[model samples]
Target: MALKAPSFLADAMLGSVARKLRIFGFDTLYIAHAHDDEILKMGIDQGRAILTADKELFKRVVKAGARGVLVSGAGDLEDLVHILSKSGVTSVDLGGIGSRCSVCNGLLEEKNQEQLKNGVPGKVAEQHREFYQCMDCGKVYWEGGHLRRIRALAESVDAKLGRAVAT
Candidate 1:
């Protein structure tokens, strides 16, 4: 059977991992100060898998009908990504790259230059021909150098896993 791309509700302690997952385009919810019970309840209610570093929390969440991953090491974002890939928990939809906001998890909508002519820096507006606006936060996104860097990183991760990029 094919694996589904699981949405995640990351516990308060796994903020970095949550951010990384978000960068990879997963719908990750990072609750930085949620109580363990609240996190478990939210995961169950939202049908979201839990990602956490607390073993006890993991056990409790599993009992509450929510799946979870108990991370063991710190400062190992790449390793966490690898683990998710190996577990069939991650899917790379490179085609939808930059479709989501990196900061607020909002969907990005295309914006014309005229609409942003006043808000963007003069040099940026003059140089870049395309722009996307975050529907939730109103932040603008462009096909900047950062996109290339992220794509390279995703490619490396895919290569390391010996898997073809998802369509």
Candidate 2:
């Protein structure tokens, strides 16, 4: 059987980290105001590894037959990404494929130039023809200069893990 990509349930404390995971096309769920117990339950129910800064929460969930990561600090997103990447808790699939939405966890749909004219800024719509939209949240996305920044950050985390930009 093929191994599936690891899914994650990020606690409220790691909201920014969750966003970065989603930006990398990981199936990360972020519950902004979730209680510790609720977050643990979500991880159990969804079979998702829990990522939290709270050590106690990590201990609690890991004891309950779930995998988790206890983040050291909340200073930087890049650090968090590096820690998680090194832990081998999640695999980063970096082919720039449509996997997850940065805004919402919904799957992304490829959209052509004509489809994005009304959604994005005039400059972006005119300049970039290729685009993708999130089905659940209707947010538009495209490969812009920011993608290069994200790729650089991922490379900084793991040179081999930065495959998302090869597309």
Candidate 3:
């Protein structure tokens, strides 16, 4: 099924994976020190797929009728992609390419010219007209050289995963 929010609740052991999922534009919640019950409850309550390394926990959540996936035998990006593939995740939302915030999991909104004058540096304000600001954290995003690097990295990851790079 297509997820309503396309979000994941990753357990403490999968903190890095959760962060990378955010980088891939997926809304992921990472709680480094939560109990199993708390993790399962919030994940289910929020309609997020539970991603965990503990096989027993995975079984319990799955048996409870919660959508989940057991992550084991790997701890790298490639492994994460593979594990998530079972849940229908792909390269459609590459980092910074999609609307989700890279830092705060907030929806990014386009900032007007007037709003751009405040927090944005003078040089950046003059150089780029199109800018996006995070609704939750108030962090700004711009189309710059760094964005190109993100694009390149996304492309590389997609290519490595043998999937088409998102346009």
Candidate 4:
């Protein structure tokens, strides 16, 4: 298997962005109440690229000699994607969708029906044979309509970005 790209450390306000990154199978570390210094420290310590919505934090990361991506206003993904792409963050290494846990940022481990029976409802278990459990949070996930919708959205975003870049 190809090695995944470097992980990310998202600042407090960027939690939603972090979740979206996980949905794309990226290892994104999110902290809800992190100060700029703490976030930068963690990013450096963990060898993670810092993601922030604050210009000061972005500048700090750059000054401190750390890799970072400054997401534009309020975590809009198109802008985030654009900024990340500019910093060499591409979908080429993003791997399969939903491969990481949106909740705890853990890798999703494939689990059979029996392993997830307790967490899943009886009807769901009977209907679905495949399941994935978050290795960190134990949240159970199944391939249903949401997965398809998210995937479609991702594809659309990619296509739009491609077109925008080509112009």
Candidate 5:
């Protein structure tokens, strides 16, 4: 059997990181107002590794026998690289992009243009044929200019990981 990709529960300070992780096809739960206890319980119950910038919380997570990573990089890219590296991901798979909901950490299902009548704007429908809807939040996603940016960011991440692995 194939090993499952690691899932994550990011702390409040890592909200943006959580969204990015979801976009990269990783199951990431971001609770903006959750207490540390809640975060720890959820991470353990759901089998998710806790990602946090808090040194104390990370220490507690480790003490509790839960998987956790302390992310304290200066830039968003650096943080992402750190998290991915800690998770054993040496490269980003572009194919996994848009596989999950960036907003809700939900699975995305492919949707036909005709299936969504009023869900998407008329202009967007004309510009893109492929679409995806979040099974949890009903958010629509398409290959807009954002997709290009996502691809570029993924490439940069891959390059950085490559350099790290090489040396």
Candidate 6:
């Protein structure tokens, strides 16, 4: 049987990490308002590994026989590297083709420029030929400076993983 890619349930404190994970095409559920018990229950029920910075919550997760990762990194970059490493992702997929919506964890579907209608500013539509819309939230995305930064971070992650960055 083929191994499934790891999915995650991140706690309120790890929103940034969750967004980065979604950007990297991982399935992540960010529970910002749920109680610890609710988060734990959802994580186990959905078969998602819990990502948390709370020591007590991690302990509870382990005690309940749920898979969990204790994230205590200095920043999102470090936490992301650690999480990806733990999930056995040796290389990052820097291509934005399969990325999820950072805001809602929804799948992104590529859309033609004309299909965007009033979703994007006129200047953005004129400059960028490619576009993606969140299938769940309808948020529009295009290649921009943020994408460059994500690529650079992916390169750094690649180097740290001892893998050559894919062009």
RMSD of each: 3.6, 4.5, 4.1, 2.4, 1.5, 3.3
Compared to the true structure, candidate 3 yields what TM-score?
0.74
Q: Is candidate 2 or candidate 4 better by TM-score?
A: 4
Candidate 5 has a TM-score of 0.94
The candidate with the higher TM-score, 2 or 5, is: 5
TM value for model 2: 0.83
Q: Which of the numbered candidates is closest to the native, going by highest TM-score?
A: 5
Predictions in order: lDDT: 0.73, 0.73, 0.74, 0.78, 0.88, 0.85
**Which has the higher TM-score value, candidate number 3 or candidate number 4?**
4
- Residue pairs clashing, model 5: none
- Cα lDDT of model 1 by residue, 34-89, tens digit: 78989888888988878877889988977876777777656544655555764575
RMSD of 6: 3.3
* Model 2 lDDT tens row, 1-167: 13566778888888777777777777889988978889988899988888888889989987898877777665545545545554453444556434568777888888997766688888887688788899999988888887777776655554433432332
Query: Where does model 3 exceed 4 Å of error?
Result: 1-5, 72-76, 94-96, 160-167
Model 6 lDDT at residue 36? 95
Q: Which stretches of candidate 5 lie over 4 Å from their true place?
A: none
Worst 10 residues of 4 by lDDT: 86-95
> 1-167, model 6: which lDDT tens digit per residue?
03567899999999988888888788999998989999999999999999999999999999999988999957877787777777667767666424799899999999998898999999998899999999999999889998777778777876776542232
Off by over 4 Å in 2: 74-91, 160-167
Instruction: Please name the candidate that would achieve the greatest lDDT relative to the true structure.
Output: 5
Model 5 residue 141 CA deviation (Å) reads 0.7
